[model samples]
Target: MNDREGGPSGLRQRTRRAVQAEIAATAMRLFLEHGFEATTMEQIASEIGISRRSLFRYFGTKEDIVLGDHAENGRTLKAALEARPADEPPWEALRAALKALVESLPYTPEDFLKITGMLHASPSLRGRQLEKRQQWTELLLPDIARRLGATANTMNELRARALVACALACSEAATETWVRSNGTVDMERAFDEAVAAVRA
Candidate 1:
């Protein structure tokens, strides 16, 4: 809403995203404490000193809050991919991007585990997370398409999306393993293991 108000000015967009992340982080803590099914929009809204209707202005559903900032994180992830050396292979470059995402997020290991565990436990949450990954694939498409020696057009879109999807699945698998390990394993290394298993 705020982003739309000023026609997507950088400052307004960043300010709006900051508020969204704050709301999401606070709401996620509530989710961890009360459980996802038990937490309500009213409770999250009250905690943030906003009305339930106002909360909807930021996020459309309960699943969205706990899922975090997909668009913002997608941009962050794409930047990470873009920064990788041109000579690196696609999967290797994607690994770097995924690693960068983990490093850039505001979660401590305990907080991350709490949220991730909730994702594992809830069907709706897991579905939303998958949808977010799909969003990330679109954000990541053009650069990856270029890396594959293909232009990012209608003809090449499917090929590029497929490549990004595989990398995201590997990333997701690594994340699941990390949660199972109680966040003890290095994320990048976990991703490497998943990639290795897929190759094997």
Candidate 2:
């Protein structure tokens, strides 16, 4: 068996991640140049010098290719939230986590606008975006509950869920405002205000 740490398995995982990133970059370029619906799996594979089957192995569908990084983002958010000091209030921890999430976006504001535009223009992508948000909320719920020291059935658990929801809403609003401003507005500041508003 291969060593678990920084061995063949690690190398393979890194390679896979690299290939996936390349595929996503290539697909985004094509989608932007052409249109999301006009872009095809075969075209993406051809541009990346990979077989169509290989592309399928990395991403099940065109929408998946566009939104694949969201899973990683969710993991990042969860980790950031969990890493917050135990003594911090739940809202404070959540605010920091949401800021971390924004900072972790792999693209610049211009690219974010392009990607968000593409999603807005495509009904399928918009649906997938909502699905991804729901997935993130679910991924974070248990951690939020844990941080609040609440069992599943406790009122504190309900409060934790509500706080998570508010944070998410604030994040969405901040992102939209930033995108609309063409990146002029400060996303972190917007998020901070949003969190503060929720707390009040």
Candidate 3:
């Protein structure tokens, strides 16, 4: 057997990830059925046959479960942006990076739409999501700045910040539209249309 696959550390890591996934899945189900605000962490833990304390070890709060780990997500987005071809236009690179980000999402498309709709409708959840997304801006700005050949000059820095902010906003808009339309809207196409509209 492969050492990495069968080693104690690897085994423990795998166990922890599996448990985390289960907790998240159970939480999502409860949130959707009972409503995010109506659902309690203890209810989620009971449904999963784990203690509420154990659930906290995996997620600090219900919001954390719904949003996942934004810091980790920011790192992933930055890496994806860095992997884009240097010659690609900044806008094109950002669009491609967003596609990569979608590939990392945990839920099925159906669940995603439901969760997104719920999230957007919830003031607290939307605020929390926005706050977390704000942290991603810094991680993304460096790559965006490089792509634009931007500099520390105030206008250039603002331009870089604007581009990154626009990309994130487009992503959010597309997802919200997709959810609002009850999955009739093609999310990728909606995102492209938004980006094109901005460019125009």
The model with the greatest TM-score is 3
Task: Go through the candidates in order and give each one's C-alpha lDDT.
Answer: 0.85, 0.84, 0.87
| Clash count, predicted structure 1 | 0
When summed lDDT is taken over every stretch of 10 residues in candidate 1, the lowest stretch is: 1-10
**Root-mean-square deviation per candidate:** 3.4, 2.6, 3.3
Residue 77, candidate 3: how far off, in angstroms? 1.8
Q: How many backbone clashes does candidate 2 have?
A: 0
- Residue-wise lDDT of candidate 1 within 48-152, one digit each (tens)? 999999899899999877766767889999999999999888888998888888889888878878878889889998988888878898889888888888655
lDDT (Cα, tens digit) per residue for candidate 2, span 111-174: 7788877887799998998789888888788777877775668687778778788888888888
Backbone clashes counted, model 3: 0
Which ranges in model 3 have alpha carbons more than 4 Å from their true place?
1-16
Clashing pairs for model 2 are none
Candidate with more favorable, higher lDDT: 2 or 3: 3
After superposing candidate 1 on the true structure, give the runs of residues whose Cα lies further than 4 Å from its correct spot: 1-19, 150-159
Task: Report, for all candidates in order, the number of backbone clashes.
Answer: 0, 0, 0
